[model samples]
Target: MDVALQALTVLAAIALGVRTKGLTVGLWGAAGVLVLVWVFGLPPGSVPTSAIFVIFAVVTAAGAMQAAGGIDYLVGIAQRVIRAHPNQVTFIAPYVAWLFATGAGTGFVYYSILPVIYEVAYGNKVRPERPMAIAPTASQMGITSSPVSSAMAIMVGLMAPLGFEITNILSIVLPSTAIAIGAAAFVQNKIGKPLDRDPVYQARLAAGEVTAPEPVDIGVASASAKRSTWIFGTGILLILAFGIFEGLRPVIPGADGPEPLAMTTMIQIIMLIVALVILLWCRTRSADVPRAQVFRSGMSAIIALWGVSWLANTFIAANEDSIVEGLGGIADNAPIFIAVALFIVAALTTSQSSATIAIIPIGITLGLEPWQLTAMWMAVIGLYTFPINGSQLATIELDATGSTRISRFVIYHSFTIGMLVMAVVSVLVGLGIGGIFYG
Candidate 1:
């Protein structure tokens, strides 16, 4: 009966992701775990914490960033890049989507960038779906390999006992990200009418009014604010420093273990604080909206992540053993298994952080080698399933046709295809295992 209930709960969460609707409502399926906890106590002591503090922090962080026009700054940059050279849009779109899907969480990326891509596609007589494909696939690469991502963190811990070095592990996973992006691009071009002169979306383009998109309003420089290049340098320095922190975390001699902190969480905290200070400094000198409004925007955005985190944690706790076992058990066929695991967990959790925490550690423990582990990690980048994933969702919302609903059948089945493709390749590439089991 308990197993049956777990199955039902899992189905419910995936159903929401698959259907591309009732996003917040879809996450409600995880509440089933709270009920289970009431009945079964808890899964384990190390179960992912879905506490309120994270919720507070996420919401506050978003509010702060938005108030400072950080998201606006990003959008302006994307638009400039896409508009400058139209043909490049087809090729670079996937990488851009992947970057967002991985770094920003698929849902946030989808929601934010979809409008821009939609406008770009519409402007160029390109199929909206063509560009859409890249984001989901690319997203998988970005998140799985990202040090700040939870899955990477989990794998970092999981691989430690297996004698895997983080540096070598990165080398293997990076290529897989490229492969996922390449495959997504291949598939997109095949399905989509070529932008130079395509028919399917072209008819729609003719019917639809095309116009120049508004240049993004990257906030103007304040007279009081120094117009020096230091801000740009600061941003670059922050990124480089972040990379250094992420790369060095695993080598810190006590970075891995139960209840240990991941570099992502720490860096995120630091970044959040820096963002807040930047906001405050800018707000004080420049006459903008009231301070209250400034704070509120970032707050609202951040709040959403907390609920998102809970949904990720709850689902994993309920089905941790099955997920880890299922993925890890694919010993001889490890790469394929990893691919399947990536899609399944990403679809259900929306946030890679939660899925990574649930699955990566277990796969490592099950004897997946660094290459195999990286392959599995790389294979996990399928991002198109749930529109809730920030980037994919952004794509769907971006569709000017008002007809970009991603049916459950399409996403789940597509994932199946993607996994099989990667799996078969993994076998040929010596990354898969046909038979292995560990508990």
Candidate 2:
């Protein structure tokens, strides 16, 4: 009875957070933690200080890059790429979205390119929904694969202690997610009616509600923009190099032996330097960094991760013995249940970092191998199960042609098929890659 009540408290907090959206999720999670500690008498768990600081550093650099026009420069390049392949916008657009998210280390960068995607598709008389719906899903999937993203930061922090390096995680995820995006795009191309045959779009066209897409004017990249983007790209490359070749890292004498600097600490140091370099060399004002969209979104993720992860960790710590006893046998026999749990939690939270911080630890405790858990990491894209995600809503609003839409049945929205396909394919591919690498 006590355990059941504690579980109910955690669920109720997550439900309220999802209902309210935005920063309130953190507030509600903190409230749940208070109740658990004061009312239920459970001890508080350790705060996720390492993950929080890594997110802060990475977001700082990304925000600095955005303030210095790096994101605009990248978006201009994406615009040209999509426009060049008008007929294949469905195939090209999602990959562009994924690339932007992976490079910028945040999916919010997908917003600037959304209108461009709509223009390219609509101008070609293709269904805007075909590309727009799946683009956001692809962007979200990119987060799991991004080295500097909050989800990846938390994942690295968790798995590094178990002998899994950043390279191993990325090796499994990057190829799997990239392949999954392609599979989803292929599936999405076959969905929906042709734009000319679509009644809603035709009706909108006849009524003059839909206008011809205006030419996208992604302004030329100024010197400042080009410099900042190159600097940021250099930073990402350096991080990847250090991760792939641990010998490149500085070694310090320790109590036992010389220890190479930890990747978590290295990431923080490098990103902080990157932010400072962009600010000084690119002539960007420090005041504008905090105001950047990526910074705002990243801060919200930190808050949500802090409260929710603390609550979850505390609850799990308090009931570790019981939880392991109850779920261990099932997990050992049917490991897919662990993936399903990750998917459901991700869908409920709608924040990849929060979902990761909250659930991955549980999987670890259930005696699952790090490779097994890593293989299932892409399952977090289930956040798209509902159409309430910001990117999904933005895509719907951006399509003036009325081709993209949510069905009366909420679950049957435009993004559903692509999201489902991506989830299934990525996990299967990840399992195969993980087996080769770690089996």
Candidate 3:
């Protein structure tokens, strides 16, 4: 089969899957793999077993926490902070969103708090779009810094052969991305007219189309909710601490004397243990676990990654020589092009883990350094460039003031500036950090 035709098949599968929505995309991806195997005579690619399991276990724990009211408890704290610093909401709100994503290790947790950001900013006469637009993007950016994020898991595994570990990735990404998100918040604060001075908002108000978003009345916080919140947070801290201090994980006797637990297995065990604790002590209904938002989103990601990554990898493996011959000269001369390629792939696939699995091997094959690849990891957050996903749609919906919107050109959506700022700044910062420490 012609490599161009093979590539087109992969693209067609992605387009069809995205168009159909839901689980169908994954099915399409699987179908692509079958077509390549049966029609093109390509070898079967390995499933992303480690990435899938890590996502499942971590999301199961997060979902358990959500079902037990732990999510509400965390959001309650964020609400109080926003209420207390109404004048500083433009600055405070994005960090609150960042904390939620960083702690939960998935951007889905931001949905529970998006309404709060809108309400607080609106009540204070702030341009709701300023914070509303950037908060969710900031949360997704937080994934790279999240110690247990599935994307980070894939990144860590990919960089391992280059002598980079989870700790090294964290040291570079955490501070770099954190500061980049803060920079985005600062820039967003000045993005549009203040709510009272805004023309669109005033027109809506004059036409009786806009009103204050109804205040959310979260009932009293329960003891179980508080217990679950702390327990879940503690679990996140443990993951961070162990990730930073490699010796903390228990070493099992091995032929090599002793071997520390693999990070993948460690994450699976820790998250499942947290879920068990939440159920046993927090009194969470076991039946509700799979129904939680985190679980549903995680499962969708797993399916998307399973099919998409497999199809992509199969295509790439089949066309390795052709790809190398065509792009090798440019890659050798300007390796930073690798990051640009990743950003483009992420925008198209709309899945960070999928993009990472698809392209990082090519970087290695082209002799890009570990630090270079680590910095390029920041480029995967480009999934927000198109703004068609659930989180972006939720932001557009939650803002009653109509200040948050998608422009006629889809690329000009509310999140474009912040996402671009974050992606650029984090990649540059990661590059600098990786060079200094890993050099």
For each candidate, give its TM-score against the true structure.
0.63, 0.98, 0.93
Tell me the RMSD of model 3 versus the true structure: 2.1
- Per-candidate RMSD, Å: 7.0, 1.1, 2.1
TM-score for predicted model 2 compared with the true structure: 0.98
Q: Each prediction's Cα lDDT score?
A: 0.47, 0.90, 0.82
lDDT of 3 by residue, 1-439 (tens): 3898888888899888878866677789999999999998999777767778878888888889889988888878877777788878878877888877788788876787788788888888888999888888888877877876778877866675466777777888888888888888888888988867888888888999887778877567889889987888887788777777889999998777998776777877888899999999999999999998878978887888789878978887777888889888988898888888889878887877767877887887777788888887888878888978899998888776788999999889889898888888888988888889886
Model 3: CA > 4 A from native: 252-258
**Candidate with the larger lDDT of 2 and 3:** 2
lDDT: the better of candidates 1 and 3: 3
Candidate 1 residues 40-92, lDDT tens each?
55552233332223323333443344445554455455556666666556567
Local distance difference test, candidate 2: 0.90
**TM-score: model 3 vs. ground truth:** 0.93
Candidate 2 regions with alpha-carbon error over 4 angstroms? 253-255
Name every residue pair that clashes in candidate 2.
none
Best candidate, TM-score: 2
Winning model by lDDT = 2
